[model samples]
Target: MTVQLNNGFLKQQTGNTIQIDQPVKLLVVNLMPNKLETERQFVRLFSHLSLDVAVTFLRMASHHSKHIPEAKLQQTYATLTDVYDQQFDGMVVTGAPVEDIAYDAVDYWPEFNTLLNWRHDHVRQSILECWAAQAGIYVDFGINKRVIPKKLFGVYRCEIDQKTALTAGFNQLSMPQSRHATLGHINDPRLAVLASDPEAGPVILASKQTHSTYISGHPEYETNTLFNEFNRDREKGLPIQLPKNYFSKDKPTNTWQRDSIHLYDNWVHSLKKVKV
Candidate 1:
């Protein structure tokens, strides 16, 4: 997963060379069921950047994971107390599988709220993905999520709304999305919609005041991520559909990786400008 930043399309924007005197402290609060797989996915994306990033994985103290073994969690992950006093250059809150339930009803909702508040003060830039995106908008702005009749599961074409650094190298972007809930009508003037799709609604939102970015789709998903998910659900006899625009001749492919890496690269580039 070595990404040549000097390449034509993926070339980094012209700017001062990012001073790598110290590795950027990146914290990923992973709420996905498969911790190790999620970690590898994110690390693969981060590894593409030219910057030296020291990534720290965080787990919730209140909600015990059913999928990952407790010993693995104990051996590899950190709780909030471990990094409570530390500030990070960037942080990522991954989407959890508990989208159907109310935010308050989740077991670790209270603890998550505490973490979000702490991030507001400590982190320079934070990305909230999927469920975390909905939660962030609800916490920051009074926007609520509405349940769509069917799961919005597929790779949808998104139109970039603004020419911010986050969306610097993109025109029309294709992103992978899997979620049961979509954000309701947003009325907050403080929040800016960055990218959107006709079916997926608001796919990206950014808040200048908080320095927070919310992404409704999983741009970090691997090439076969949606395929694996679809199979997993189908095997369990759950209702599932073929991921749109993801397969070529009804077969899975890795077309979205280039754009995904480009988006993440832009994010890392933005972190370099932060005087944290």
Candidate 2:
């Protein structure tokens, strides 16, 4: 991705500072068409952490963007080749809408694999969300994503499995999920389920060392994200299920969903504590 520096956002590095060469660097590979909103989500999460984090946005070169402004995409993001040699404290790969088809069908499959392989060697830790989580399972462990009979919609409760750092303080966190595809039975030996629901698929999983986080639900979603998705699909005449327990009195306009934001904060705080 292009490394265009944000002039005002960049804090000047001082030689006399206590931790002068140790600022945490995070690279966010945003696959969402709404790049600005995705950027806001990451910013909101990172801002709450105690660490000083500098984020670099990475965009896929293989796909054309329709919703994002051309100038913003060009100015903020770069192709995978642009960040190959960089070492980062953490990385986040956002979800895309390509789960219905095979990964090979997407134009950037090869590039995506390259990014994953590079992360395996270079990145200290990484988070994969939604479809990106499915992609990780497929690529790294040969696990396939199965198209569910119906879309998994709304906010669901996730009980944290305390075996890993990702759920260090999480007890029963509710997360927002807005997606059409879900992973089927995963028989991969390298993957471990971290959180699950009897009705929904496993909401969280990780590789053995907690270096990689694969979350089926979107903990980073804003309160209005589910509402926005519902409205968008409704306008487009696409089939959408009402989010479970999302609306107050079954009315979308009456209540606010505050659970996602809280859950996301917990996840970020926990991730910040992880040592490589």
Candidate 3:
């Protein structure tokens, strides 16, 4: 969220360059335990886009995050109250680790819902990634996410359907999915499935009525994300299997990173210019 002022950026503004426009304002609601890592992943993709973006990392005000230090949490993250009066060009709501828990049972459920309700008006366009995507779908379309028998973790090739700006120029794309809940049967007219895999089903969905998009995979995940997660689960004695189509001889090749970058670029391009 912090920007180091550089010569070129300053020159562009001071010299009145024709190409520069107001920086895109983006709000990221991070729900993961490793906040710093999540921040890194999202920021990496955002950094690749052509537009200059100003990002705000927001945390649930009511929930206490034990993973990050209290001092650092207060310093680095924003409470919903901090930016309630503001509006943004776009918002990114990341997935949480609480897929198995019922939505109402999560400690910050009320606060999360409050944020989503507020985003409907304040954010021009938005993305619901991973678990947040399923939650958003349930709230918006009255659909429920069923817990799958196995964790759907790995790189998957999804066939793109409806050619919206979000999925334009791609017949199919590779995505990294790491979730236990799946939208069993999406029989709603309000939402359109942009891409689907045989096993992963709907990988991307856009609301026909709203400016929000829902993604079932974690395109922001780095190459070793699933690798680290696999080890972490093993250390804790949690039941987990090797991620499908992810590992090769104990190493992972980044097959989905470029596609992920383009995916986010498309989302950024979909946003209209908003105030600084």
Tens digit per residue, CA lDDT, model 3, 116-149: 8998889998899999999988887789899999
- Give the distance in Å from residue 158's predicted Cα in candidate 2 to where it truly belongs: 1.6
Weakest 10 consecutive residues of candidate 1 by summed lDDT: 3-12
lDDT of 1 at 149: 86
Cα error, residue 23 of model 3, in Å, equals 0.8
Error of 3 at 175 (Å): 0.9
Model 1 scores a TM of 0.90
- Order of all candidates by TM-score, from best down to worst? 1, 3, 2
- Model 2, residue pairs in steric clash: 1-78, 2-77, 2-78, 154-243
| Collision count of model 3 | 0
lDDT of 1 by residue, 194-276 (tens): 89998899998999977899999998899889999999999999888888888888788877778888888788778878854
RMSD for each model, in Å, please? 6.6, 5.2, 5.2
> What Cα-based lDDT does every candidate model obtain?
0.83, 0.71, 0.82
Q: What is the lDDT of residue 36 in candidate 1?
A: 61
TM-score of each: 0.90, 0.83, 0.90
Residue 232 lDDT in candidate 1: 95
